[model samples]
Target: MANILEIKNLTKIYKEAQNEICVLKDVSFSVEQGKFIVFIGPSGSGKTTLLNLIAMLDKTTSGSIIFKDKDLTKIDENLAAKTRLLDMGFVFQFDALLPEFTVLENILMPAIIANKKAKTYAKYLLEKFGISHLANKFPPSLSGGEKQRAALARALINKPTILLADEPTGNLDTQRKEQIFKDFAQTAKEEGTTILMVTHDIHAANYADKCYKIEGGKVE
Candidate 1:
């Protein structure tokens, strides 16, 4: 598989009151197409910060993030937003589905934003996640697992080149978390969508094709 994203000597810092705190220090890695990569670390170890940098949700203090031969660290927010919408999908631990919309509508939000018809693919994703029956229900009416499943479907509705998830199964039970990991693995294997997930669940690393650990603001 080819490299979908590359991070070289990436670093992030926070300065307050004349004190400098380093979150991610010279972290480097490459995500290949169709592979599941997980970062396992303790709290405050910069896992989410790293994900934010990769997703363009935050800026890097130094170094470079390259995607498709372009350096994302140098891009303007407009271009970054456009690139994120066009090439990336993000799933947070909480199911961020819209309450006013039905599950189907929530799943189609990406397509609606892009002004493209994705009903067929959205339905396929719902079926694939075994929640086709819940499509017509509102988010508040669904269970946690169901909501997360719908969120997963929504994330994939755009068929992005990569998916960035931050502790995606944190709100679920063990059984549900296992199911989510299986679904994530299957998605990467079948649809060839690159997956980068950050979680403290060491067990979750089992389902990933590549696993890295972060300690003292460095990844290995």
Candidate 2:
């Protein structure tokens, strides 16, 4: 498998009260195509910050991020946004579904925004994730697991090459978390999707192809 994402000497800093808070420092990693990599760490360990940088949702203070052979750190905001829409799928710790839209509609929202033809595939994903029964229901009516599954379906609707998940199973119970991880693993395998997930649960990290532990802004 070829490298799909690369990070070199990544660092992120935040300014607060005349002090510099270093969130990440000298982090370097690479993710291969069709592989699932998990980052596990305790709270406030900068895992989320790393994910944000990788997803291009936040800028790095310094370093290089190469995705699909292009250097993201050097790109303009417009190009970064375009790249994110075209190639990245994100699952937040929370479902982040729209309360006004039905499950199907929520799943189709990304495709609509990207102006991509994906209605048919969205339906297929809904069925694959076993959320077809709730397709017409709203987000508030669903269980946590159900909502997460719906969110996953929406993220995948665009058939993204890379899926970035932030504590994807954080809100679920043990059984549901296991089920969701299984679903994620199966879907990534079938779709040849490269997944980079930030999680705290050791069991959840076990579901990934590889796992790294981040502490004090460095991977251990």
Candidate 3:
């Protein structure tokens, strides 16, 4: 399989007053298409920083982030925003669902933002995730695991080429967490979506095709 994403000599530095903090130091890796990749580390490690850089949520100090052969580090904000909306999907620790919207509506939000008609595909996603029964339900009425499943469905509504997940299972219990991991692995294989996830939970390693350990600003 070809590499869908590449990170080379990536570094990030944050300046606070007179202090300078380096979160990621010359980190590098490549992700193959349709593979589930996970970065596990303790709090304050550069795992989240790495995902932020790839998602273009944060800028890199100096390095290259190549996605589909395009240097994301060089793209302007407008193009980056378009790339994020059209080609990439994100799921963070929180479900981030709107309480007023039905589960189906929430899943279609991204497609709506992109001016695409994807209601049928959204329904399919819900069914695939085993949450089709919750289509008419509001987010507040759903359980923690159900809400996360809805969030996952929302992320896939656009058929994004890559999925960026940051501690996506953080709020779930053990059973739910493991189920989410299984879902991710299956999604990667069946949907052909390259997945890059960052988390402190070591259990995620069991589901990943490639696992990296990040600590003290380095990956190994």
Candidate 4:
């Protein structure tokens, strides 16, 4: 498989009270197309920060992030935003679903924003993730697992080339977490979507094709 994402000598720092706190230092990695890669670490280990940088939600202090052959570090805000919409899908620890929208509506939100055709794909994902029955229901009415599944469906609405997940199973029970991981693995295998996930659970990381542990701002 070809490289879908690459990070080289990445570093991030936050200044507070005349002191610099380093979040990431000289970190590097590459993700291949159609592969599942997980970053495992303890709390405050910069996993989320790394994901944010890769998703273009946050800027890096220094270094390069290449996605689909483009150096994201050199892109302007407008181009970065466009790239994110065109090539990236993100699922957070929180479902981030709109309370006012039904499950189906939430799933289609990305497509609506991009003015893309997605009804058929949305319905298929909803059914595939076993959330079809809750299509008309609101987010508040669903369980954590159901909400995450809906969020996953929404993420895929754009059919992005890369999916970035931050602790996707953090809020689910063990059984539900296992089921979701299985679904995610199957989806990656069948659709050839590149996935980079941040997880703390060893069992969850086991589902990934490759795993890296982050500590003290470096991959171990």
Candidate 4 residue 141 Cα shift, in angstroms, is 0.9
How well does each candidate superpose onto the true structure, as a TM-score? 0.98, 0.97, 0.98, 0.97
Q: Pick the candidate with the highest lDDT.
A: 3
Task: Give the CA lDDT, 0 to 100, for residue 135 in model 2.
Answer: 95
Error of 3 at 219 (Å): 1.3
Error of 4 at 190 (Å): 0.9
**1-220 in candidate 1: lDDT tens per residue?**
7898899999999899999999999988888899999999998999889989988888899999998888999989999888787789889989999999999999999889988899999989999999999989999999898998899999998999899999988989999999999999999999999999999999888899999999898999
* Collision pairs in model 1: none
- lDDT by residue for model 4 (1-220), tens: 7898889999999789999989999998898999888889999999999999987878899999999899888889998888788788999999999999999999999899898989999999999999999999999999999999999999888989999999999989999999888878887898888988888888977688999999898976
RMSD of 2: 1.0
Candidate 1 least-lDDT 10 residues: 81-90
TM-score, candidate number 4? 0.97
Mark the regions of model 4 whose C-alpha exceeds 4 Å error after superposition: none
Which consecutive 10 residues in model 3 have the weakest lDDT in total?
A: 46-55
CA lDDT, every model vs. true structure: 0.92, 0.90, 0.93, 0.90
In terms of lDDT, which candidate is stronger, 1 or 4? 1
Candidate 3 lDDT score at position 151: 93
Model 2: lDDT equals 0.90
What does each candidate score in C-alpha RMSD? 0.8, 1.0, 0.7, 0.9
Task: Give one digit per residue, the lDDT tens place, for model 2 in 117-215.
Answer: 887898899889888899999999999999999999998888899999999889899999999888878877999999888888999776889899999
